[model samples]
Target: MTKTPPREALTLAAAMNARRLSKVFVADQLGVTPAAVSQWASGHRPVPPEKAVKLADVVGTEPHLISARYAELQTNESGNVVPIRQAADGADERRNDLVIARLENDVDSLRYALGALVTVMTVHRPAEGAAVAKAIRKHVPVKFVKQGYVAELLGVLDKAGHE
Candidate 1:
């Protein structure tokens, strides 16, 4: 019989820790029993591809990492072995900071766009339809506006203006 790879097991363990997800919760999310989750974690059984991806989602880890760890665990039966390589804590912190910065920038841009929409709709009520549309286009991408979120925002603005 083939052994579970170390990387695969470590990845699964790391994902659980990173996500703060319980083994029982992950199993429930995957529609499996907690015993199955434990088995996978213990490297006694291999996780199927589809279930592995679902497990990763529950664990908030990439599916690729879980797959790699599963392979590593197959090679080492000790179960205590580390299968995945983890970055230094400082490096992890830096990556999280970068993620937060990007999220903040996105929020700021969205807020600016919403403000522009409100400004154009309220103060410039007599403006031509094309001008209002142009202002919206300038603030938000055409593709992004297609999902009706822009319309919803405009509806709110209109209601707020009335009250």
Candidate 2:
């Protein structure tokens, strides 16, 4: 019996298939080594926020999706913003803060987009709304959902549904 040879692993193959992005291209764009990109793609290393932003830009995706840290940088129990990484120096720290603020703004925009989707689904197709919302909830971070906006929107949806 002839044994089949093991398939060779292609670096960043999924990204290449989905977005036509190669590890070399991403490494060049991010000023990092292909090995670093491979580490991130393999989930062996966490992507930093700044690099996550650049990676998302290169791959045409959201930073939160790339960086676990950014995804967890949501409001706290006291409604205070969670702390992000602090730079060692002054200017870098300020810049990092600005990036964090921008990320928060992006999260707000995502929430608005989700709210619109939920509104449309609930009003146009009640049955599918719950399913769509469930799928979205599964993907979104728990802290983001616990922000109270989703619940408030659902209350409005319920009122509309009853009428």
Candidate 3:
């Protein structure tokens, strides 16, 4: 298994106290639960590098470097928040894209299967039963991941056409 990153023993509470701030105020500023702030202050949980870096400015302490993951949030002496080392972000986006592509493929397969079924019924059935087949075809339901419920009548499924 991969090793976990090192955690800094941050004097978060002291820093907050020096800045004349309360735990709730610091917790609100960090967008974390008060318990998390308490944990960080009491050394129960190590300070996250991102939070450590962010709190450096707020608590007047040096930004503790933890790992490459926090490099994206690197702030310069000019104090500009630069978005760098986006490889991890890119990987996540690629994974999401793959999932969406697979879902679209599944939808396409479902539509094709329904079309074949409609075609077989429409072709094999006699002229007298054409209206019944047409009705059944119109009533055939297939689910989609997005765009909600829909029915493909006469072998046609269009998102814009329905909604």
Candidate 4:
């Protein structure tokens, strides 16, 4: 009589069997070298932290069992040793903050241009205002108009001499 082997030993092998999931295919899905997959499956090396979650999902197993060091790769971009959890959250926040700042500046510039356009259209050519606005609205959507960018839309009228 023989005991059943643990699931980890058979995981990648099973995936391979299930749908002809080849080593190259699995490596592509997991963003790893085929050699890395072979080493992990053979128990020569523990699965790396980044690949653990995806590999666990692929094999339908809990992540911690796949790799004991599931949370921390303990290496930084500059090669300094640090807990990934600590740096990861801060780096994500900084990226979000930078993106938000850039978007805000872009919207501000749009608003200033819109204000200038309104001054040109209504003050300069008040009579043909409706026609000029309609022509510009053909290009700019209603959302921008509601967001107070109607003036930029109407700025097109200035170029076309619609006024």
Full-model lDDT for every candidate:
0.64, 0.64, 0.54, 0.62
Clash count per candidate = 20, 0, 0, 0
Model 3 clashing residue pairs (backbone): none
lDDT tens readout by residue for model 2, 25-138 = 989999999998877777667676668667767876655556666555533435443433322445445545666888899989998997887678677887766665565578
In terms of TM-score, which candidate is strongest? 2
Off by over 4 Å in 2: 1-89, 132-147
lDDT by residue (tens digit), candidate 3, 1-163:
9543334334455566778877787678778888877777666676676576565565665554322233333543355433333334465455446557768999889977866755554555435234644455556543422233233433232222232
**Cand. 2 TM to true fold:** 0.40
- My TM-score estimates for the predictions, one after another, are 0.38, 0.40, 0.35, 0.35
Q: Write the per-residue lDDT of candidate 1 for residues 1-163, one digit (tens) a residue.
A: 9765556667787778777878888888899999988877767766765575577678877555666534333222343322223434454455456557768999889978977766666666634434555566679887775657676665555455555
On a 0 to 1 TM-score scale, where does candidate 3 land against the true structure? 0.35
Instruction: Indicate whether candidate 2 or candidate 3 has the larger TM-score.
Output: 2
Deviation from native of the Cα of residue 83 in model 2, angstroms:
19
Instruction: Report residue 35 deviation for candidate 4 (angstroms).
Output: 33
**For model 1, where is the 10-residue window of minimal lDDT?**
74-83
In model 2, the Cα lDDT at residue 105 comes to 96
Candidate 4 residue-wise lDDT, 1-163, digit = tens:
9645444546645655666666777788898899988877666677776777687676655555556455333333454434333456576465446557768999899878767766676767765766767766677677875554465555555544543
